[model samples]
Structure formats: structure tokens, C-alpha cells
Target: MTFSWRRRRSGRGGDGKSEVFKGINQDMELTIPTHFRCPISLDLMKDPVTLSTGITYDRESIEKWIDAGNITCPVTNQVLRNFDQIPNHSIRKMIQDWCVENKSCGVERIPTPRIPITPYEVTDIRSRIVAAARVGDARKCQELVGKIKDLAKESERNRRCIVGNGIGSALADSFESFARFSVDAHVNLLKEILAAFTWTFPLDEEGISKLKSAVSLRCMVWFLKSENDLSSRQNAICVLKELISADQACVDGLMGIQDIEETLFHTVKVPICPKATKASLVIIYNMIKSSKEKSGEIALKFIRMGLIHLILEILVDGDKSVCEKALGVMDSICSLEEGRENAYENALTVPLLVKKILRVSDTATEFSISSLCKLCLGENESALVEAMQLGAFQKLLVVLQIGSGERTKEKVTELLKLMNLCRDKVDCVDASMGFKYIKRSN
Candidate 1:
């Protein structure tokens, strides 16, 4: 996006303002040349960029467009192969020359565009980061972190480049490698790694896969337990959050770590930040996502760590996102017998599950129903009584009659069948609606 900067803008009698833009006067609103205008802003492009689809726009406008999560070219609506936008140096030069020609009329030359760091350069710096971490050189690590921070600050493009060139994977590898160093060295190394993540180098799938090593997992726990560096701990949590969500394989590996339960519980029990809190919950969900046996074991550990009560606290006070994730973990934890027993014994459990039914999004509703099915599908009288008192039957009737998803409706049927098995004792949702218990649809 480099453009010549020799020209100057003409101001209105030393008012120190750009009154003339190329040949168009700002006050006059004269129709400027269309080619010089950025399609997005419909004004002259200070730094024009050309997309792969051959559409040119002002740098700021196009970058904002890409950042909005759009994958298609704005003008053509064609799918983009990548988010990379090429700098139209020639168009920029033309605009600058025009500015210089009109300088007598008060137009000012735009400064040359700042080039974002390339992926090759990013790859080189990231290798250096890993090298520094390998030797546990504190100063070198800090300097590399500073360099990455500058790259991330330069443009959104550089941030993408950082991820594309595999810096995220390198950081994960660094975390693992640093574990061989002394505790203080590893902690310092982790802090620098976290500093890089603050700019949010999005980890790619390959990176997440490579991060599954036992050493890396232990390092993450170590970070969560750090007493000295709160910022690094928060960043570590953030990194863990992204890393865990990337792959079930990574999560499955962390299962062997005996102390992970305590670490994850403490993380959730007293999160350093909202991001960390959400990450803590997400990591638990990852652990329980795979197998029912695994789920039961993890649930037992979570119960031991008082994860249930902590989740309830989070549910009540958390924002929609945290509440949804909390519900997700609750659903998994409640699937096993230990989880069910723990949940049934808790006073807040049934009521909170019912409260979340339609209070959150459809995903929350799904988890709530699933958890309820696990809790109510047995001869657990206490759970049944809680549901009856909490008006859960009425809610189920509303759900069925109002047309819930096919799968949720099936879980509701199981709930009713269980309730009617004790129909002689409790007044439940009347099966008189001729609602036969339907098998749950996958």
C-alpha cells in the first residue's frame, strides 16, 4: 500500500486543514474521478488495496470488511481464497501524483503506505522465538515478543501472517520445550509466550494438533498455578482456551495428568478474568467430550473439586456466552452416575437446569434437556420431586406442545415415562395427550 508522499494538501489560508483533495474541493463536494475513489467509501482512497477478485478499495475500509468475518469479496460477492489483500501500489502512485499536480490548489500528498510484515518474515522471527525459548534466554524472548507485538500492531494482515506462518504452533512447541528448563525459566518463557498471544495470533489446526504433548499440557497447568505473573496466567488461560477448542485429541492426552482436575477447578473457582473463566469451562467440556467412561471419571474428579457448585455460581452471574458454556459442561458432567448423584443432591441443580431451558439460546436448551434426561430417567425420587415442585412438568408440556426440536422432544418423552412409572405418587405431565414415548432422534 506504498504511495508517494512528496505532494501536499492545500489548506484554506493557513487553517491547517485539508480543503483540497487532489482536484476535488472538500467543501464543494465535486464529483471526483471514480477510479481514484474507494468503492467502499465512495471517496478518494488514501491507501487503495486490490483484492484477489480485482476490486480496489481504501485500505481501512477493506480491512474492516475482512475483519467483520466476511469471506466473500464485497463488490463481487465471490468466495475469497484467502483474506490477503494485495497493495495496488500503482493506483496509489497515481493518486499521489494527482495530489502533487493539484498541490497549487491546496491538495496534500498522502504518506507512503506502511507495509505489513510478510509470512516469511513472521516465520523467521517465530523460529527465533522458539530458539530463544529453547535456551531459556529471558532477554531474547522478551525482544522477540516485542518484535511480534510490533508486527501484530502494524495491520490485521500481519496478525493473519503470524498464524499462517505457524507462530502459534511455535509458541505451543516453545511452551513444551521450556518445561525442560528450570521452573523460573519456564515461567519467564511462558510469560513471553502469553505476551505474544495478547495480540491473538490465531492458532491453526496443525498448531493445535502439535500442542497435544504431555509436556505442553503440564505447562498449561503450571501457568494456571503461577503465583507471580497474573498477566501471563490470564494469557495462558486464553491460549489454553483456543488450544483446547481446536482438537479433542489434545484434550484426550491431558487426561493422564492426575493433577489436572485441581488445576482446572481452581481455574474455574477463581478465574483471573472473564476470558480465563470461559476458558476454564471450555477446557472441562473438552475433557468430557469423548467417552462416557471418561466422562464419568472426569465427573467424579470435578465433583471432588466442587466444580458443580462453582458452575452454578457462574451460571447465575455469567453473561450469555459463559452461561451457555457452563450449561454445556453441566450437561456432560451430569451424564454419569456420579455426576447425577452429585447434581441431585445439590439444591440449586434442578431449578437452575429448568431456568436455563429457554432462558438462553437453543444450544443451552439442548444441554438442559440432555442433563434433565440423565437426571430424571431413573428412580431418583429426590430429582423427580424437585422437578415436580419446580414446575418442570408444565415446562415440558409447553415444550412438546409448542414444538421443540425432534431430539429434545424425544428426551422429554423419556422424562415423562420415568415420571409416569411413579404416576401413582406424583402428578406429572399428563400422558393423556396421547403422547407416546418416542425414541430420541440422533
Candidate 2:
């Protein structure tokens, strides 16, 4: 198959990284050499890399093939003994030279590609990390972890290779061992360790379990305090979210830490990054979800912390996804009497939820509807009357007409029934005898 490169001006992408091979000039016609083209993509190779089968292709093309579980070379049909793709530096140089020669033709030189960190190198780093941790060499451990963090930040491929080599678990183990001693002298080391752990997200089961340990929890809690830097606290909260989600037991020990509740509340009350804020919300939701026995007690605790008013403020102008997560927290909170009362008392709560019914995504709509049902169905006809006044009935009709999930539809139907029942009691009441007397005067 023949491939054509689209013409475009060279510039950086949204990530602020230089655009690769996007500077080809279509107006100035020039024939690209066959050897300079990737066999898989049939396009000019941007980062030509030779595989074990002695055939060259673009790094992206080959990586995609291997990631799709292909074991054989695409050109030779020979089984790949290893996944290594060595950079064809000579060919790359020749390509650049050709581009320089054709400068009059508007040919742009392909930038030199950074070699991806190999698994072998990552394994070597892991070994040294183990040795350093074993000998209680905090200084060496810090240097090694810094290197690992740099590699992880370099590229997605390097991060994958680092995680595949079990660097995350190794770092966690090292941190635990070192934490057994005084960590005051190694504050920077602890910060680096927590940040490194955050970079290796979607952790394996072993990594999750290791992070769930008391030592790891203590370390995370220490950074979460208001005294630490924002980045350190952000990393700690992120890792804590992963651990708590993986195991419910993690939440028990985490909640027991002194000032942890205030720390988490402060983290949520003040925005760090979207990611860390979302993590904080998830942690709060999970805490409520896991402690079914004490769910009401937990809900009351958060309500006392001003969670109800705080989330109402979020729902006002938060993005669709954040609104959805915030609504989920509200749903969990509204499961209890105190939570429902707090929500009913908040003037923004009912109206905001009604607006979200058919406006946001289905997940958000579901949570909104569920929370609304809980609030209005409680020991007050006022919530029901206020909901109808906010045009909730009209929105529910739209939801039913357009159709929603079974659970959402059911809640909508139930809420409609309740509102329909409340209409008689609400509408019959006289609005104002003074207005009627004024009509008589007119």
C-alpha cells in the first residue's frame, strides 16, 4: 500500500513536545527513497529501527505491532526472538543528510530520536535499588529513585518498561524498610519515593498490597499534612486512593490516622490538580461505601465537615465529570437521615440536581435523580413541592420519553409518582390572602 504524508507547518503539540515528521512539504514534489520508508506503514520512516530479523520499520509502527501480540517480523515472517528494536543511526543520519541536501526543496530534517529505556536497564536499576535499600544507604537510594523517576517521566514506553521491571514494588519495599528508621533526615527522599510511586499507577496486585501496609500508610499520611509541599501531598493522596480502592481494609487503617480526616477534607476543600482532587473525592466515597455498618456515622462526620455545602458549590460550575463524581458522593451521603436533611436544607441542592437530570451524562443524571429521590421522599413535603417548582417533573418526562437505564428509569418513575401525589396537597394551599384582596380592590 502506498502512503502519503500530509503537508503541515512544523511546531510543537499541545504537550509542548516537537511534532515528529509533520513538516513534509507536499507542494515541493520529491520522491522519498524506498529504504527510508517503513515496511509496515509504507510511509517515510521518522524513527527507523531495525529488528532482530534485519528489517527496519518506524519505531511507532513496530511497537504497535508488538503491542498487538504479534511475535513474527512483518517483512520476513520470522519469529521475533526478542522485542528489541535497535535504532538505525546510520540510516537516520543519511536521511538527515538527504534532507539537508534538498533544503531548496523544502525538506525538513527529522530530529534525532531518543532511545527508549530498555527492560534490561530498568532491571539493573531495580537491583541496585534493592542493594541500597538492604544496606540502609538512604543517599544512594535517593539518587537511584531520582534516576527512576526521570526515566518514567521521559516517555510512555520508558514508563511501561520501568513498571514491567517491578520498579514500583521495589521502591515501595525500599521505602518501607527505610521508614522503619527515622525519616526526618530524609524528607526529600520520602518525597521522591511518593512521587515515584504515583507515576507507576494502574499498579499490579503486589504493588497495591505493598502500599496497603502500615508503613506505607504512615508515610502517605505524613505528606498529606498541610505543612508539606503541595506536590508531595498530591502524590500521597493519589497513591492512597489507589490503595484504598484496591482493598477496603486500607480505609480502616487510613481513617484511624490522627488528623487524616481534616487532611483529606482540606485536600478536597483546596484544589491541587484535577487528578488529586478527583482522588480525594473517590477516597471519601469509598470510605462511605466500605463502612456499611457505620455508614450513617461516617456520613454525619462528613456533613459536619461541611461536605454538603462544599459539593453544592462544586455542582454549580464544575465540569461534567467532576459533577458526576460529586453527585456520587452526594448519593452516598444522602443515604442517611442527617445527610438527606442537610441536602434538603441547602437551597442549591434541589435545583442543581434537577438541571443535571437530562443535561449531563447518564452517570451524572443517574446520581442526580437518585439523590433527588432520597431528599424529597424523606419526612418533608417541602422538598417535593420545591422539586416540582424547579421543573423536575418536566425533565423526568423527557428522561422517560428518551429512555434511560433500568435503574434510572425506575427512580424517575418513582419520583414522578411522589411528585404527582404531592401536587394536590401543594397546589391547593392559598398563595396569599393579600393578593386575593388586591384582586378584589382592582
Candidate 3:
């Protein structure tokens, strides 16, 4: 049903009728004006802002759309030349006036939205955080961190403005500077700093270097083991992933901390959250991808810690995204000769790696194929035989038919040739052989 209100105007040139609205209100039977509604939400625009494409939307809706990585105008689909949000003051005023006039119909006026924080304000906040950290003022530092976290949550604009002003580097610098303070007395301060740092992710090179410092690494490991709050631990792991990726030297720093590997292993074995588990996998991958000598040492450490078994189990149980990350860690470890030998010895390795081919994402497929190739190319004939019996040949053929990158295609072709060369041995192998468990050599 259409609801409208028409008021007569008494004037010389008046047409004697006023404009009408097309709106719907099932309970109150009230009609709203079409022009007063936001295109994206189909509700009255509370804080209308127009885009460069001449389309107007509610501030919250449009900001969320843009923040989600969209660059086009929601209505027109035109590419946004800039990210500027121009407030539609006249439309907001009209909406307020309409709400007041329709007060009897239960329409309430929306309060004016506060202006977004400016870059200069974020710079000042950064200075305060730095100053607090410099003086070893734990109380002051925690308060400033809390305030920054609250400001970040206020709006996307605030976050962008703060990030643009380099709050990430400031937080990392402050966090590193906290090494002089006592850990027991400043747990809350460190935790709050980590919590706030998560809001400023994708840190720059300078920030990553500071966060990966020896002191920072030790403190983060402590948080992972001691913090009762799951979010705090997850944030610590997330930050660790960045710090580890900063450089190969980062792995050397982690090796000195004996419990860090164990902590990460337990996290993967008994996950508190999918995100934490995936981050742990990436961290392991980076450690395994370290410089030649350190890479072997780190890979051996994790393998002895039973990370390989956990990775195989995750391949069977995890969702596609988690499986992809697990495969990445597997691929990196298998790059080492010792790693390949360990994988070749495990019964679950062949079956699980074969199971992942073409089943998950393309990246997962690449990792699975690369790791299998490494293991099969080894001196172990049984590894190749296991691959053939476990349907690796068929899955690999399917991968080829579907098209792959040049490098993947090369590995696929090479593995297929090797398998075909041993077709006689493969046929004699028992088809019912569920798994071939080759015990690790002493």
C-alpha cells in the first residue's frame, strides 16, 4: 500500500497541491519519501554522503563498502576517482525536518554524526605513546594504548587516518622500548600494546624490524604461553607471523628461544582458533624457509616436535583455507633433504599428499604436487611405488588436463614419466595395500 501526505499552499501561483511521497510502513501506515532513502540500505539516510559518481549513501554503509576494498560507486558501478566522502548537509537537514514533522508517526530524528578524526590528531596520539614508552611509564603507556584502540574502533575513517599517520611503526617502536621494564609488573601493558597493534596490521619494514627484536620475540612467546585470554594469544601469534617474515635472520632469533617452537607446535596440535592455527603454520613455513644452515636446523627441530604428524592430520580435517596453509608448511619443510627423508618414511605422508591434489585450491594443489615430487625423486623406490598405488598418477593426470603453471606442468610431466617408467613394479604392488609405513632410519 502507498502512503502519502499532500498539503495545500495558499499563494498566487500555487497549484493548490503539495508533493507526495511513496513509502511503506506496515504497522504505522506511514509513507517515506523515495529521495530521502539511501540507495544501499533502502532506509532513510541518517548521515548522507555523496560519492564522486553523484550517488548518495549513508556514511556507515558507504564507508564499510569502501573499506571492504571496493573502488566502484555502489549504485552506478563507476570507478571512484578518489575515496573522499562529501557530506550531504542539505539532505541530512531535510531528513531531520521530515522526521520531526512525522513525529506522530513514530519517526525519530537521527543525531548528527561526529566528524571523523584527523591525521594531525593521530600523530599527536602516536607521540604520546612514544613518550610514555621512553620514560618507562607503564601506567601511562597502557592508558594511551587503550585510547588508541578505542579511537581505531570508532570508524573506518579514523583507522585509515591513523594508519596513514604511521601508528604501526610507533606502536612497534614503543613495544620494543618496553624491554627495560619488568615483565611481571607490565604484563597488562604489553598485552594492551599487542591488542592495539593488531589494529595497525600490515606494518612497514621498519615496524617489522622493531617488532622482531630479541626482546619482543621473547615477550611474545611468553604471552602465547601465559595469557589466559585467547584473543591476546592470537594477536601475539599474528604479530609473530609478520616479525618472522621480516627476514631470514628472524628465524635465528627464534631458535635461541627453546620453548617458542614447542609453544607453536602445541598451538597447532590443539588449536584455540582457526586463525591462530593458520598463523602458526605460516610461522613454521617461514622458519623452515630460512637460510640454508638455519633452515635445516629449524626444520629438524619442528619435525622432531611432531609437526609433520599434525600437518598430515590437518590435511584430512581442516577446511580448504587451513589445508592450504598446512600444505605450504609441508612444502617448505620438504625442500630440505632430511625433511624429504622424514616425509618418505611416514605412511600418512603419501596418502595425505595425494588426497590434497586438485581437492583444495590451486595453491594447495601446487604445494602438494611439489612436496610429492621431492619425496618421490629420492632414492626410496617404495615412495614412488606408494605414490602409484595411492592414485597419485590419476590425480596428476587430471591436474595436467586442467592446466597448470609452467613450473607445475614441468613437475607433473617429470613425475608422470618416472611413474610410467616403473609401471611393471606398480602393477605387481597390492591394490588393497591401505598404507605403506616405512619406519624412519636411525
Candidate 4:
């Protein structure tokens, strides 16, 4: 609806006709002048402010327009003189008066808007948090942390202010500093620190490195086991993922932490958060992708902990994203003979792996075939018979006819040939067929 109004002149240019907005109540009506509404939002101005062009707009709408890199005025195409929003108290007060006058017509008055906190204020909070940490006063530090959280939630402008000012480094420094703190204080402090990282924008390379160096591995292990709050636990895992992922040396260090391994296994089975679960899984996958010796050790551990069972369960029940990760983790672990032994022993392994074929993404397809090929080609004859009895022959025929990537198709063909030779020995196949996709390039 277009609402228009003209200024009344001292002469007879004034018209008795007034624009009216009828409320749901038949007797109640309100009339908002066009000048009072923002051109961008088409809503009554809550905190009207004048731009460099002397054009009035709601402070938030114009501020966002400027923040988004627009230099021209919304109404007039003139370039902005400067990106300043001077508060127009006169117009704001007029809007408030109008809302008050129309109270019976269901038009509610807007509440006072809080100004965004400045970088100076965030820097001051960081100092207070540091001073509190120096004095070992957890209470004061916690209060300051709560204040930071409140300021961060106030606005996107305040959030950028927090990041631009060094809150990430402050939190990382604080986390490392409080390692020797009392148990309750340490856990509480860790929770707050992770909260800051989570709610703040993402960390830069320097900030991530600082946080990774500050990570106390022992405390994180205890956190995974002892912290009852799921969010805190998930935060701990996220921190580990960043630290371990940044450098291969960090992943090597984490491999020795038995508690880290144990808790990761626990999380895979009983998830705290979907993200945490995936991070935990990806960490193991990263370990497997690292040095061969270390990858084998982690794979054996995963088998002993029955992580394969949990992975298959997720592949069957979880979303496609989680399924792809699970498949990758499985493929990584299956590089070890012990891993292959455990997988083939499980009755659901081959069938479930086969079920994932042509169902999930192409990455899932490659991993599934790679895992099966590992078990069948390397050693375990018993695993080979298990694959056959579980309908591997039928699945391979379908796979050959439909086909995938050249390398994947090559692996499938090799498996078909290998299993075909063992047919009479295992006696597990009904029939076999050949396909043109398997033909060698001339």
C-alpha cells in the first residue's frame, strides 16, 4: 500500500482529506505519513537517522546498506559524501508520538535500540578477563566472560568489533594460562573460552595456531569423559580437530593419548553432537591418512573398540553427509590386515557395504569397493568366501553393467575375476558374466 502525505502550507493548499489505515477493530484507524517510512524497508522508522545525503532512513537499514559497500544514496543516486548515520531525534520522536497516539489502533511503539559496542569496550573486557586470570579469581573472569558473550550477541557490528579486537587470542591465552587452575575453575574456564570461539566468527591462521599451542591434551581427555554438558564436550572435540588438523605432527602427538582414542571411540558410538561426531570420525580418518605406522596403530585400536560396527550403524541410519565420512573412515582403517579381519568377521560388513553402493555419493562408492578389494586381494580367504556368500557376485555383476570411474571399474573387474577363480573352491557364486566397460584401452 502506497502512503503519501504533503506538508500543509500557510495558504489554502492544505486539504481536509487524511490518509487512514484501518485496524482490525472497525472503529480504530492510523495514518502514517510517507515521509516517516523508510524507502528500503517501507516500514515506519524506529531509529531514523540522516545519511550524508540528508536523506532520512531507519538507522539499521541504512547502516547495513553502507556496511554492504553501497556508496550511493537509496533514493537519490548521488555518491555518499561519507558513510555516517547521524541520528534524527526529531523524526524518531515524531514516530514515537504517532505510535503513542495510535495505541488503541494496535500500532505498538518500538523499544529503544541499543548502540553497538565499540572495539575499545571489547579491548577493555579482554583486559579485565586477563587481570582476573592473573589474580586467580575465577568468579571475576567468569563474569567478564558473560559480559563478552552479551556484547557479542548484541549485534553483528559488535561481533566484528570483538573479532577485530583480539578476543580469539585473548581466549586462547586464557585457556592455556588456566591449565593449573582448580578443577572446577579449569573446566568452567574452558567452557567459557570455547563458547567465545564458537559464538565469535571463525579464527584466522594465526589465531588457530595460538589456540592449538594452548591446547592442554590431558585436560581435553578429562573434558571428554567428565564434562556433563554436551556442548562443552562438543567444543572440546572441535578444538582438537583444529589442532590436530593443522599439522601432521599434532596428529602424531594425539595418537599417543590413549584417552583421546578411547573417547573418540565412545563418541562415535554415542554421539554428543552431529558435528562433534563427524569431527571425531574425521580425526581418526586424518590419523589414518598420516604415517603408515601410526595409521595401522589407530586402525587396530578402532577394530578392538568395535568402531567398525558403529560406523556401519551410522552408514545405515545417518544422513548422507555422515555416511560419506563413515565410508572414508572405514576405507582408511581397512588398509590394515587387522582392520580387514574385523570387518570380514562381521556378518553385516559386506552386505551393508554393498548396500551403500549406487546409493550414496560417488566417493562412498569408491571407498566401499576399495575396502572390499583390500580384504579379498591381500590375504584372508575366509573373508573372500564371506563376501561371496553375502551376494558379492550379484552385486559385482550389477556394478560392472552400470560402471563407475575408470579406476573404480578396474577394481570391480579385478574383484570379479579374483572371485571367479575361487568360485569352485568357495562354491559361493550362482553365475558370472563379462562386461564391455572392463575392456582394456587399445
Candidate 1, residues 100-200: lDDT per residue as tens digits? 77666566788777887777788788889778877767678777777887777777767776767878777766666666565465566566766676555
Q: Estimate each model's TM-score.
A: 0.75, 0.87, 0.80, 0.78
lDDT of 4 at 199: 56
lDDT string for model 2 (220-276, tens) is: 888888454888888888889877766778988876677676777788888898888
> What's model 1's overall lDDT?
0.74
- Full-model lDDT for every candidate: 0.74, 0.80, 0.79, 0.74
RMSD of 3: 9.2
**Residue-level lDDT for 251 in candidate 1:** 68
Task: Put down candidate 3 lDDT per residue, 329-437, tens digits, no spaces.
Answer: 9888788777787777778999999989988889999999999888888576788888898888878878888999988987887787677667778775434532122
Q: List residue ranges in candidate 2 displaced over 4 A.
A: 1-27, 76-82, 103-114, 425-442
Best by TM-score: 2
- Ranking of predictions according to TM-score: 2, 3, 4, 1
Provide the lDDT at 351 for model 3.
92
Give the runs in model 4 whose Cα sits over 4 Å from its true position.
1-32, 44-49, 59-68, 131-137, 181-185, 245-249, 291-295, 379-434, 439-442
Runs of candidate 3 exceeding 4 Å displacement = 1-30, 38-43, 49-97, 100-111, 246-249, 291-295, 428-442
